[model samples]
Target: MSTINTLGPHTPRIALIGECMIELQQRADGSLQQSFGGDTLNAAVYLARELGEGGAVDYVTALGDDSFSDAMCQGWADENIGLGMVQRLPGRLPGLYCIQTDAAGERRFLYWRNEAAVRDCFTTPAAAPILAALPDYDILYFSGITLAVLGAQGREKLLATLIEARQRDARIVFDNNYRPRLWASVEDARVAYRSVLPYVDLALLTVDDEQALFGFADCAAVFAAYEQVGTPEVVLKRGAEACLIRCGGESFEVPAQQVERVVDTTAAGDSFSAAYLASRLKGGSPAEAAEAGHRLASRVIQVPGALIPK
Candidate 1:
């Protein structure tokens, strides 16, 4: 219910917290194309593109002092994402993941990320300043993947920051991108998700992920649960189906755009969430925003990777 309009004419400063990994995409010829991608990072890039000069998007995470990390920082900068809050740790490296796409464009992933530098992001001594500065942003965005990667201690610190950020009137946005392999158990993921739900102002939820994580019987059940949590705005994304939105005590459904050929399904949801949030930030209604989300996602699924060309 809280609108960016309340903040007057000032451009919103958005900070997205999570990890960006070194990405390897296996090609049809059996070669590999190396790039960078992650859930929140992909959202950050697309959000920046969607918002353009309408807002400021910053990425908050820790990376290594290595060349890959350096290239990642430069790439984010080229995308117009702020790097002021990024931390670089010596002798540490970022995570890596490989994407294998079938002929149908559905993706399967292989990860090597247990010891990534971002796991210690909020636990590091240098992180104190970044954590302290996080509460000042106009919007603070993160995802369930952030919860899984941060572990218990880092999540505690992040929760404390979210509490303070909410108190300072920063709108909290959450994307429920539940990854089973990232958490120790399903119960652990549920607890972490429930802990953050109360603080979220706008929730960008994937219906399939919600069902997998909470065993919700259907979309109605998913919306009912978020209603109980008092989330002001909720968008339920169902791939290839209509996206349902509940906001301001009303509901709306926007049909997903049809795509003839699907090259890769990577970043489809991330791109959708970014476009939806960008539209809302720019004063579009829920219906308009969902349309924007669908349009972007349709294009994204036709691409080969997480980020499409500007």
Candidate 2:
């Protein structure tokens, strides 16, 4: 790959759109610790940590004016994540979820998010400015869970914004972190994914998620679908295995770092995505970015939470 794009901007401003919920983690001793997390939120924090002066990472979401939401914003601010695009609805509240992990570090989630404030993130009157401002960013990042939460109208608005952003040469990045329970039906999910895939410049995908979403036979099938959409850069993340990257008619396999003991795999892919994009924005080759992604994910899995200490 050339490592430079004519329309790409230096010191990029990245807006990551999604929800951040009140996350409760069940400890092995039956105790629980509360925190804030979501697929895109995790990526946003990691991106902020990785990019520093290289770029600015902002989170775009709506939350209640409650104290929990206030604490959440404070936490994000502490991480140096920009919250200028985040909205606080007077009567709304953020979603909630509980994470339970097995001995193998595999995680399962139980969600109580149906009435979260973010579901209307793009539908409120105040969202007009946010929507209008979206195209101004240098890079836009989102995930499948973002789509599921937005519903029909929000997705339509987001789609329109993405189209406009692409016309202005803003690079769009997508992560296929699919959660089936969040979607009403598989067909609906497929349609939403198809609508956005063509507009994405870089796609971060997991082999297992692709299989669950599209019933893809193998990695080749996943790559074929992405190739059809003309996504210029694609990274296929396989837990504990080499990640495959396709770019500029070439493919690279980057091996993941080996972790001696795994504590949690909650944000493995999200952390990887953030590091990969940060590396790319810093002018690293796709192969180098993939390695960077794997390196960060290795450490994240060794920790008990989505974010580790700086």
- lDDT by residue for model 1 over 1-310, one digit each (tens)? 4753355578999999999999999999999999999999999999999999999999999999999999999999999999999999999999999999998999999999999999999999999999999999999999999999999999999999999999999999999999999999999999999998999999999999999999999999999999999999999999999999999899889999999999999999999999999998888999999999999999999988899989
Candidate 1 off by > 4 Å: none
Candidate 2 per-residue lDDT over residues 1-310, each given as its tens digit:
1222333556789999999999999999989999889999999999999988878888999999999999999999998889899999998999999999999999989999999999999999999999999999988999999999999999999999999998877899999988899899999999999999989999999999999999999988988888888889889999999999899888879999998999999999999999999888888889889989999999999988777888
**lDDT (C-alpha, whole model) for all candidates:** 0.94, 0.92
Against the true structure, what is each candidate's TM-score?
0.98, 0.97
Least lDDT summed over 10 consecutive residues: which range in candidate 1?
A: 1-10
Instruction: Find the candidate with the highest lDDT and give its number.
Output: 1
Q: Pick the candidate with the highest TM-score.
A: 1
